[model samples]
Target: MARRLFVENGFHATGIAAIAKESGVAVQQLYRDFPAKEDIIAAIVEADCERIADQNTLNTAVANKDRAGIIGWLTTTPCHKDESGDRMFLEIAAEGARNDRIRSIFQGIRDQADENISRAFAGLMDSDMVEDEHRTLAQAFMIVSFGSIFLRTLNQEPVTPASEKLITCLIESATP
Candidate 1:
């Protein structure tokens, strides 16, 4: 509910009272749950992080040292097909630009994602440790993922094909 409101009306434009009203919860109760609007936004982002940050598949592939499995994972963009979700993310990103708290939240997500991607790169190369090359490729992959989300949300064409191509190139180059 707050997610929808944030996407439609934006972070600053959407007030606690509005969210409370929209969610059919009393403002006091909402306050008890989330002291501030930032808290609500944090909750939303945390849920998204949990949903999208599942590294089990990658961990399994890495544990088994499956190069093909790692490549398959790398090529698959996790960007959801839901435009609303993407819009919500864009909104949060915009807020994060000016808000320190939001920026910290997003930074944490980025750090975790980078770590996971770097580990995956190490796995892809059958290396026990992540090298500088792996870290650099992880950073690039993160950019591609963010770019794909932005392009997809904007209804731009050729995002997937281009993103896939870039990812494949990255994977191929990273392969030993």
Candidate 2:
């Protein structure tokens, strides 16, 4: 309920009353559970991050030795397929800018994702190499991956082909 409202109306534009009404919970109960809208947003973001980590399937891919497949999945699979999902993503990102708590959550999500990407790529290549190198590549991979969605959401040309090519190249470069 709150998720729908947040996706439709945005973070700042959404109100506690609306969330309560949409969720079919009493305002007091909602407040007791989540003292503030930011708390709700925090809970949602944390859950979403965990979901992304799971959906990436990076660990499984690495375990299976599917090196090339990881790049394709990471750049595309985690991205939202529809515009509304993209909008909610962008909105949450913007909200994170002014809200310190939200920003920290975003940072944690990014850091955790970077670590996972680095590990996935490292395992895929069967290499025990520089953490710094893998970390840098992971950062770039994330930028290109998320940047594609932002570009598409803004009605710009999709960046998937290029991001895919870049990620593939990075993977190959790191390959032994």
Candidate 3:
């Protein structure tokens, strides 16, 4: 219910009353479960992280210590296809840029993702890659993902081959 409201109205426009009505709960009950809309957003973000973490691609890459595989997992994994899903995430990110609460939530998720990538790289390379290197790769991956999202949102042409090429280059650079 909250997800539908958030997707349709955006984070800024969604009100607790609407969520309560959609959920068939009193506003007070909703507050008891989630203190604020930001709390709801955080819960959704956490759920997304959990889902991504459980993917077969990530699990296999982590088990086999495959850097390229890990990159593939991050880059090639299909995101939600529905417009509502896209809007929900994009809205959260856009709001995060201006809201400290949202920004903190995003930052936590980003930090955890970077750490996981660093661990995956360490296993693949069998060498100690510094924190800075992992951070650099994480930022690059984030930019690539966001760029793809933006292009798709704008109805631009597909860039899959180009992205794969770039990922290949990054793998080569990261390998020992």
Identify the candidate with maximal lDDT: 1
Compare the candidates by TM-score and give the number of the best one: 1
At residue 147, what lDDT does model 1 achieve?
Answer: 84
- Of 1 and 3, the candidate ahead on lDDT is 1
lDDT (Cα, tens digit) per residue for candidate 3, span 1-176: 88888888888788999999999999999999999999999998898777665556765777776666776665554332445555666777788999999999988877867666565555456554536776676577666656665666557456667666765665566677
**Candidate 2: which stretches are off by over 4 Å?**
63-75, 78-82, 128-130
Can you write out model 2's per-residue Cα lDDT over 1-176, one digit (the tens) per residue? 78778888888889999999988999999999999998898788777767657644776677677776666556555444556666767877888889898788778778887878888767756764437777887888788767876888887556566766876676677676
Per-model C-alpha RMSD:
1.5, 2.5, 2.8
Q: Count residue pairs with overlapping backbones in model 2.
A: 0
Ranking by lDDT: 1, 2, 3
Runs of candidate 1 with Cα error greater than 4 angstroms are 156-158
Clashing pairs in 1: none
- Rank the models by TM-score, top first: 1, 2, 3
Q: Which tens-of-lDDT digit does each residue in 1-176 have in candidate 1?
A: 99999999999999999999999999999999999999998899888877766677778889999888777667664544567777877887788999999998888878988988898899988899999999999999999988888888877554777888888888888878
lDDT of 1: 0.85
Superposed Cα RMSD, model 3: 2.8
